[model samples]
Target: MTREIENAAGIPVVQIATIVPIMLTVGANRIVPGVAIPHPTGSPELGKAGDKATRRELLLRAFKAMETEITYQTVFE
Candidate 1:
């Protein structure tokens, strides 16, 4: 879906995925490695404040990835 959206709509997208290799195999151009499979943005081990911070960091990374220009698939590790 992400690939289709980017190619068909001519829009940039950053995919936040736990399994980075799979997303890369599927040709996801921009990827931010997620925290975990079940909790991609927020960690269950952390409290509310920590979770918020984690999510915020992920969002910031995504924004950074979106602003970057790449000729091929790129991972914002």
Candidate 2:
């Protein structure tokens, strides 16, 4: 689906998922390692402020992944 969106629509995609191996196996070109399965961006245990910070960091990484040029599948861990 990611490849199809990129290929057919000409839009770069960054996939944020906890199951990195599965995304890679499925041929996701740009992947970001999510924090957890339930909460893929922020950790609830970190409290409000910390969770916000973590989420920000994850978003930044995802943006970076979208900006990067790659010939094959890559993980922004």
Which candidate's lDDT is highest? 1
Per-residue lDDT tens digits for candidate 2, residues 24-58, read: 89888999999899999898999999999999999
Off by over 4 Å in 2: none
Off by over 4 Å in 1: none
Best by TM-score: 1
Predicted candidate 1 versus true structure: per-residue lDDT over 3-41, tens digit per residue: 999999898889998998899899889999999999999
Q: lDDT per model, in order?
A: 0.92, 0.91
Error of 1 at 7 (Å): 0.9
Q: How far is candidate 2 from the true structure (C-alpha RMSD, Å)?
A: 1.0
Clash list (residue pairs), candidate 2: none
Q: Which ten residues in a row have the lowest lDDT in candidate 2?
A: 2-11
